[model samples]
Target chain A: MKSSIEVHNLTTAYGGAPVLWDIDFQLPTGQIIGIIGPNGSGKTTLLKTIMGLLDPASGFVKVFDQPLDKVREKVAYVPQRESVDWDFPASVYDVVMMGRYRKYNLFKRTKDPDREIVLQSIEKVGLSEFKDRQISRLSGGQQQRVFVARALAQGADLYLMDEPFVGVDAATENSILNLLSEMKNEGKTVVIIHHDLQTVSDYFDYLLLLNTRLIARGTPAEVLTKENLTNAYGGQLTLLSKVVNLIKQNEFPIREKDSDV
Target chain B: MNDFWIILTASLVAINSALLGSFLVLRKMSMIGDAISHAVLPGIVVAYYFSEDKASIFLLLGATLTGVLTSLIIDFLSKKAKIQGDASIGITYTLLFAVGMIMISGWMQGNVDIDLDCVLYGDIALVNMDKVIVDGNLYVGPRAFYIEFLGFAIIGFCLWIGFKGFKLLSFNEDYARSLGIATGRWHYFLMGLVSLTTVVSFEVVGAVLVVGFLIIPAATAQLMTDKLKPMLLYACGFGILAVIIGYFTAVYFDVSITGSMVSVSTLIFLAITVLKRRKRQTKALLKSSTDLRG
Candidate 1:
């Protein structure tokens, strides 16, 4: 089986300082991979680099054995939910239709088939009822689902989502995860930038633990060991464990300084 | 009867500005439109100085070029100097406008006459004097009308054809770029269109008043709805309405028609905002009442 995405020595930066340093990874086709990291761990940067949103200072990113730009049609991206202005005057249907725009000629109107695909995508995301609703009126979960529906409308074989589960309710998150699993079953590679450690084992088949660089890449069981967790999280394992215990007890956990010096 | 023609011409100008303003508001580049309006004055003055005539096409072309150059300068300064977008626009427009005023006072003092007061507060009544005769048929209207009409058509066509791209680029440029859309190209293209419109309309509305024409109607529509197509249509409707009503008001009062039109637009904006606020309050009250009953 061939890898769907290959990033070798990828380093990206905004101006002079680098955001992602010496990142390397290979994602196989037809698998759901979770990219877990701390805040500013370059998870979004890695995804953006692979998607050709930002040019890597020195490295190569190949999608399906070709340059990312050449294989753009085969890849879909769902950016961070906060990247767009919800107040923008567009309906859910209008946003989904945008995914099909690249397939059409610049001067040509969207064809019937494109419209059908957009409708189907909306239906797939359980947003058919809200197709005509203005995007600003939808809740957070619904907005996230609308963007997912847009990616589905693209009909790409590979999807790169940045924090799709952020601020979403449990039901919406489960539905989105299920939809991603379904995509994997259909031989699509889905790479998601996920934050939760507890759901890592169940949600993804592969994991890429990153802390501004490649920490580990393997199955969840293989990479989520105590040693790898400590390396990626950096002395925060006790805090993570306490939070997990608090969640299990239905109480919020607050961290305090252990001034035992 | 002459007042009717004045109203008609103002209405056309309003319609053009409103349509173009819709996109400008959406992109949040309304200030750039404002800047181009002022910056084009130097171009017009220079062209008039060289041609020794006010009716030369060179003036229009030069104004359009300078409008585009003003946008580029703003973009460059914003990027290079790390200045805020609005600040860059302000600096560019003020400098260019000052230069234009100096040039008008120095070079074209006695040779060609272009009134600075008329440039600041347009002369719609005088539009009847600059008539173009086509095949011996007298078309009694300002030459500015034809230029603005052609500009509006081009802008309308561009907006109609590139509606989806513009929407995508405006709303989510990063996503658009990742989707293989050249969002930067579209941004520059939209700015170019805006500059073109500003140059053509400058002759009719002046510089400062064009800001009202570019931002007011769109803002009024924005207060009313959250749908792009309807917002644009409503803006055009509001603009035409303001122009008609303001022209008559100016005629009756013997005052500045441009000022009246802008004041009417501002009033419409305020009215919509108040009405929307009241409607929201009512909905909130009703929702709380239902919650209490439950």
Candidate 2:
């Protein structure tokens, strides 16, 4: 079990307050790992620190047994859909082509093979018809797909995503999960920051419950214990019950599907 | 010859502004250009008071330093002190601008050519009078021509080489950084470009209206096109067109050249906005008529 990410004693702060303090964990390679936490629980901060987008104040983050710069090309990140200005004047193809660009090819234009990869990435996400359409005209789900396509085009071994399913349609979410599973089958690792605890078992093979600190890390069944939920959620009744219900459904296995309520 | 120099100088300002201003506008730092332009005045006044020479190149050095400081102060206040971004910009520029105003008022009663009115609105028509005399007396073109052209050439070369880097930085900074590109370096490099451009353009449009040259044409081009490349080219074309119209308008009406140029740029922006509004209404009307027939 090769380690994909090893964060040790990492403390990242914005200015005065530390968002993530003394976070220590190692995620295994070739697994869909979800970092679940409430809002402002430093979920995004952890991903950013691992991607070397933020400087950790007190500790270090290692990727692939080396520093981030040494293995940056092997990592692809999909920032939150809300983080970017959707109104920017770029077509789907233009935006997807940004991932095909590496530091070595900064001065050179895209070659024919890279062009084919960009188009194939676009098609993989079912956006081939809207390749030339301006990104601002895209629906939220389509825009989310565009970002996934960008991350996919990087052809990286490790993918870090911040809330990729937020505000996406059912079909888009399903397609992205399928796409991510395909990547996992190819022996790539994906670490994602996700909300909605109900689907943790369905979506991720491994789980990390974060609350400015590492609360738990293991398989979904091991980490989703009632004791761990209460510890992480801090007596939040709604979230505790949601996980309780998830555990109940996992045991009973009677419902055909999760229909309304 | 005088008319050619004035229009050419203004066009150069237009081109320089568009080269860097497009990125600024997209980055949502358009007002920083306005703020830095206004804040460089104290540097100009202080440089003149110390050197006692208005033509000294140190005036540019002093003002450029002040322009860069204005942005740094804004960044410090907004990022470190928990201050709101807009309030930080407003606070930084006003303080520096007032300092410049105080310096100019005291120097105005003395035997100095640096006055408040001239600082606010520069006189571009006197460009021909400031000729660069070569080694012992061969008269070259206007000195402003050299400064403005140097600014344009340097900006063009940097943007051409770093186009992909800048494009990624402007569109998605986080993704760029994750790719191991130093986003902080490109950000400050652009700020330095904007600072240098503001200093060179400060003489032509003055401390107050330099933002007009940097912002208005880029904004107008943004309205005319959605793509960045076309936006840049359209900005250049719109700026040159504005210079021609504004130069002729100034000559016929006997007004300020810089004033007329900015006013013309603003007018073009307004005209396009109105045309776009009407086009939207027409599209809606056509859709409604077809729906009614069905």
Candidate 3:
């Protein structure tokens, strides 16, 4: 099968400093692929690059054998939750209606059929009741669901989401996983920027481990090994665990006067 | 009869500013209102120097060109020069405004048509003097009023046609771009509208009061409603209310009309803020009493 996403030597930078360096990967179509990385690992940058929100320094990205702009209607992107201002005054219905904006002409209003699609997408996410509620009133998981419903309304063949599972409740997580599985069964490609390591093996079929460069790219069993993780994280997990324990037990103090005995 | 035209002209200016201000407030570009209002000074001065006509269409075109230039410079400074957004706005406006001041004093000194005081604090009481004549006797209202009314119609039409694009651009820029909306062009279109509205309205309500109408009414309406359509209606309502109250109050108290109008706008915002807070406190109190009874 042809690859759904093909990145050839993709490098991206912010300001003068490079964040992603000479990364290359080819993701096969119709699978739930998770991009795992440590902090400052360019996972978000990679996603933004693929979505054409951020320009690549010296590389290219192809979705389904075509450039992003040529096939924009066939792709949907879900930005990170923190990247959007939740305090914005928009209803759940209004936001989902934005997904249908692509279907209308430049100056045309959305019709009843578009509204029907939005309603169905909202129902798919189980947020039909909260359709009229302000987006700011939603819980974290519901906010994420609103985003997913928007992507669902697009009815695209490829979906790119950045950190979709972060800070969601257990029920929301399960529902989102089921939705991903459903999409995969429909022969759509879903690439998610994921963080939690424990669920990596269960949630995703393919893993693209990244930390400034391509560390590993293969099946979960092949890429989630101890060596691959160490290569991506660089002993940061052990260091972070020790530091966390020290802070939790009050065993470390930044100031001399703060040390009680 | 004089007061009728005065109120109508001022209300028209208020409506235009408030209409464009709604989007600016939502986009967190309220400062752009202030920047454009101030930056239009040099353009007006340059136009008066070249054309020598205070109410010329060339003047409007010149001011609008400079306004768009101001936006472009701010973008270049913030994006390429790495200057922060607030600093870029401050630097661009103050520098352009100062240059305008120098042109007024150094070269165009004693020019009765345009001056520093008129630019900073407009002469709305004299708005009736500049009338547009069709033939020898046909009067089509004051030129300033017609200009402001034209501005209002253009902005309203644009909003009607491009409401969806503006909403997407304001609410979520990245998502708008992903949907293949031309976010960059929409951004420039909005800035252009802001510039045109400020230049036209500044003749009646000074540069400072233009910023007030652009932000205060829209912000007050925002506090009143959660949806975009109602927010626009409330903003226009608040703006017209300010014009009527401010005009009558200025007549009765013999004070500055522009200052009174801005004061009324600010007071309306403050009133809504206090009312919302009181409602919140009442809800909290009721919730606590219910918990105790339970």
TM-score of each: 0.91, 0.88, 0.94
DockQ of 3: 0.56
Candidate 1 vs 3: which has more DockQ: 3
lDDT per residue (tens digit) for residues A22-81 in model 2:
999989999999999765678888888898877899899889988989998899999988
Give the fraction of native contacts in model 2: 0.68
Question: Each model's fnat?
Answer: 0.66, 0.68, 0.59
> Residues B216-235, candidate 3, lDDT per residue (tens digit)?
99999998888889888899
Which residue pairs overlap in candidate 2's backbone? none
Name the candidate, 2 or 3, with the larger TM-score value.
3
RMSD of each: 5.3, 6.5, 4.5
Choose the strongest candidate by TM-score. Answer: 3
Ranking by lDDT: 3, 2, 1
Q: Which has the greatest lDDT?
A: 3
Estimate, for each residue in A19-113, the C-alpha lDDT of model 1 and write its tens digit. Answer: 78898878889999999986567888888888887778999999998998898898999998977779888899999998887834656887999
Ranking by DockQ: 2, 3, 1
**Distance from true location, Cα of A132 in model 3, Å:** 1.1
Any runs in candidate 3 off by more than 4 Å, and if so which? A239-261, B108-112, B133-140
